[model samples]
Target: MKKLTLLFIAFIAILSFTACTEDDGFTFTAKPDPEGISFMNQTADTYTLTSANANNLAERFVWNEVDFDVQTPINYELQGAAEESFSSYSVLGDVTDNNLAVSIGSMLDLAEEAGLDNDPETEAPNTGNIYFRVRAYVGADAGNVVEQTSNILTVSVTLPEATEDAVELKRELYLVGDATAAGWNPDNNNTPIFRDAENDDIYYFEGRFAGGDGVEGFKLIESLGNWQPQWGINEGAATSSDILGGDPQAFPVSDDAFYSFTLNAADGTYTFESIDASSAPTYSAMGIIGTATTGDDSGWNQDIDFTQSTFNPHIWYINGIEIFEGEAKIRADNDWTDSWGDDTFLSGQGNNNNDPNIVVTPGTYNVWFNDLDGRYLFIPQVSE
Candidate 1:
């Protein structure tokens, strides 16, 4: 009787073990954390969806179909203020081998595949505002699923707004002697500096040469024009009074005549000096002192003496001397036949006498002429 009882007890224990084993297969339990569901509203809009948890579902938490009844899956929708909305759903691999707990890493991978892996706390739209939520499920079984919704995360973006300032200019002038005599307002205290139309920041000064005729007197001309602010005695229409009749008119021979101007602004300053050479005359010589003709052989002919003239000549001279001290460095000496004379000397020269061109930075400048002709300095307005 004891043996039979022991056998029955063994049999009962086997049955209980079999029943427990059968109950373990494919059991679906909604996990606390959804496996693969993500949401993002890059646009200025709000979005919401149901998600399934797979914390303890393991491999049974296979997502068959993610239903976003109101929203489409893996779609980008444009919203106001250049914002966008997006949703994604993914199925994680079977977690059955890993017991009842589904790996968080797997859920993250599934979320990434579904395009819902973005961080909800920091997710933001490019402009305007955004809101996001998620939904998940297990396999195709609606009965075996869990829904997890994240808090609505909002992000705002704003667009940025063109720029203006004061004008600046830099000017340089080349001339003979100091600039004060040239009628240049160094500080623009007397005359206002003119600004360029194209660029208001640029300023220019007109250089005028004091000489004969309109060309002989102080005439403000363009830099590219035929005249310049130099102090050479030329034998043409551009000749200064000091060069024509030996008597100084606009510029005195005793003191070197120079051009000068002042700047109104205190930002910076520029200095321009004229270069002198030997080809052009610095001062004019009276006909008497430097005779172009001599008396008759009998010594009875009329001897023209410019020095004896009572009237002051308009010629350019050096301290009552007939000879000019300064000359032009760059000279084009040529002979031409005129109606009144033959073999006339014609020369073309530059103020600097060295470089034909010069570049200056933006600033105020005191322009001056050295031992050069005042009619050769060409100051032009420039822009960059």
Candidate 2:
């Protein structure tokens, strides 16, 4: 019984040793062939296919090629048929089930044959912002497979419309004040009082004029005493008290000359002037004038009138028949009152108070203010 027990123990030890040896027989590890894979024909002028493994390996390759415009056919082939001793039957055989001892050349040739070469000159259809992907597969071992996908690639081919060229036109007016006038002086002759250098096809005028004072009130008289073109004068004499409809006061005929000019590209400057000599003479005022057709005066007159008064201080006026283009207008009486005051009216009682801003187009415009003191009125130039 002791001997039999010893024999049983020996048998168990031997079985344990045999099991361990079997476990240590072999260790199989799989590593991808680095040189066996690469992308081919990656250029704008050519169609390309990507291969996963370039290194010689026992593997099977599957390929898919897509074209945006045309259908493509592809085929795979082994590299070395004779030297590798690879038979045509074995090379062309379906290696899908077998992972070991496969041909790379046969696989590559198969892919190329399937690629479309028809109409080589024809351009590929635009993908409309689309991309492509490639993948490679290998059967590392029985029931074991490995796959590598290529980096995504993109293509672009499109343009934009050219910019349009434009032409610019500019109009400007240079104004010179009457030499004898104490005001209406714009220091620079080169830089006109108004300029449309931006070529907006508009006219503009801006400057300062001295009018309104007790001594010899200034007037923008359009027509001189005789209504003769040469006899016209823009500056004249008046009294602040007279302008306010107060008792007439005699004062020297002051030569406080005023000036106005007109400008057009084809024709140069046209100037006019006038003076006031009436029983009820008034003070000089500041205002604007423009064409009646441009509709720029907010439905106001082309020859609107405006004034700033000394009585209430900080006030201006706009009153007259609608003229010009309606592009501009005088502020409402309320606005004037809010700014200056009702007392700012030239006539203390505010009678016959017509002040309005004037606007004109690109052409000549007849401009004048009512001569409360006389029949003569003045012409002023505005350029934008």
Candidate 3:
């Protein structure tokens, strides 16, 4: 009887343990992971990059999108590197819609950024293989995120050729010597030649100069303080042509006069024009005169004056000008001596005697004129 009771107690303990195990309510299963990505368009062909092909689309990188088994948005990034290991790499582009296209110019820049030899003239291997890959990642939450990387691609790239126009950049020109108003001080405001806003290669300087005889002659300096690269008139030439350097002789000016100097680097020509100060058109004060006027404006007969900004004199403004379907011209001092019409209005190149009128549609605009660069723009004002 005693042995039977002990056996019964052991059976009761086994039943209590079975009940405890079933009391726990959860069951676990693994979440689905994204599939591996591969490039659809990667090839073994070599691509030769040149300055001519810089603007052309060189390669398109396409990849399969990651499927996280749920509707989770993924961000994809295209990466590039010089080494296959991709220990150091650059994010070329953010892959939007599963693909990215890079231009030859952009790839060349990427190669340079990857520490590859960019100089085509150098003996170093200017051509090499670059590796590329794509990385896809989900949100920053560690608990619910997935990331995957694509297979690496090897692409051959050649450095761009060095061309005359490609290598040479226009340098800032400044005036020096006794002929300039600044008298050899480049730091002074009057010495720096105004670079043409439309064309950076063109430079302009207009001011009064006391004639420098042979000893006091003036020369164009690349920089105000440095004198290495200087341009002066070739021997016995009066106009800006055949400029020479390296022990250049100063172009002699005979009389003190108002001068307008234009240097066209692209054209390889320079011109020196002497002007009478009184007869020359003055652009100091500009006024608007046109069929398009504001606030009971007299149509095309009188001037609608522009007020100069106290902070910036070059900036002129006329508020609430109701531009009509007609045309207009910007004049200086309410006179036709200096007026810009049509294309000339877009390019503040002084008054065009036979300039076409600037056509405008009906809109109330705040007219802005920048005299320093000769650009006129209109900003649409909210209708009152």
Candidate 4:
């Protein structure tokens, strides 16, 4: 009787354990949020886009979060398309956050895509409408998953007329001399002066001019190695010049200082204005870090160091470096104290504000960064 009773108890215990295990399994039925996701704020009737404030925030789209009635993570995406079109929608952003910030430059780009242009001669309208909406889904979209889409919203954009005084720069200028980072070697992959966005004929750079005992001057070259169209000071004092042919006198520099150089190719004039650095901040290093660069783990785990210009501490570069497929950002001193991730232009602002990361394709590139104005350049190198 004891043996039979013991077997009965053991069988009962096993059945109870099995029942508890089944009961502990977590599962829930998914139902769409009672309050469907939609834009919480109304968009402005019409937005005016201007290049003057290209880096400024154009809009911040916000929406109500959806409760999918499940424990799985839900994803959000902002979609944009031409008015009255649901297909061919472009992803403005793919983020988990409920809000996404768009810059004025992005709005201008979308305006151009909508066939709006500032050119008066073109038949394309200077104003148009863009449609936007929010999409929410869970897990990888394999076509079987049910997704929620918010009601499409409309926003109009207008581009101002271009100024008639705009001048196009035909020539590219490079720096060569001991006073610059390339030093006396004109073939050291010399740095090119940045051109003004509005006025292409105007070029500028802010850097240190380390004066030496001999040849303590700098000159602008038209191209690498070939210095026929070189520029220097001859007719006037070192403060300004109006000559640009047959190797003019090198601009004189007696002491090392932070100088802001500006050249107006339109009028063939230039200036070197010294800046006092008694209170200005100095950085020991700067670098690029992200999924695009090869780090220890190839994410944000490490940074790919960039060589700071010996002449201009504000300038940083990495020549002929292979960048992987992903996005990245520029930060200072191996720290996040200052960083730039804006992806508006090749030579554009690097606003440290919570901007988007710099997206890049897989290719070898010559990367350049200017800390002064938060401008960056990524030029694809020709495969040899």
Best by lDDT: 4
Q: Candidate 2: worst 10 consecutive residues by lDDT?
A: 338-347
In order, what lDDT does every prediction score? 0.27, 0.29, 0.62, 0.73
- What is the per-residue lDDT of model 4 for residues 11-82, given as tens digits with 9 covering 90 to 100? 999999999999999566567787899886545567777776676555667787899988887788998877
> What is the lDDT for 211 in model 3?
80
Worst 10 residues of 4 by lDDT: 237-246
Clashes per candidate (backbone, < 3 Å): 73, 72, 0, 0
Cα lDDT of model 1 by residue, 214-322, tens digit: 3332222112222232222233222222122222222222223223322211122322233233343422222111112221232112222222111112111111211
lDDT of 3 by residue, 1-384 (tens): 999999999999999898888877543322334458877653425666665446554665777777755455677899988788998888878744687766677777766755566576676676788888998877657875566789898888876456442321224555666765556664553244555545555667655566845546577765446664565665444222112213456545566776677776543467777865565433567887777663233668887788775433455678777666556888777787667765422223434557676755566665666454355655444433
Of 1 and 2, which scores higher on TM-score? Answer: 2
Per-model root-mean-square deviation over C-alphas: 32.9, 34.9, 26.2, 23.0
Q: List TM-scores for all candidates, in order.
A: 0.17, 0.18, 0.33, 0.47
Question: Which candidate do you rate higher for lDDT, 2 or 3?
Answer: 3
Which is the leading candidate under TM-score? 4
Query: Model 2: per-residue lDDT, tens digit, 88-130?
Result: 2123432222112222333334333333221335453211221
Ranking by lDDT: 4, 3, 2, 1
Q: 1 or 4, which is superior by TM-score?
A: 4
Error of 3 at 148 (Å): 0.7
Q: Over all chains combined, what TM-score does candidate 4 have?
A: 0.47
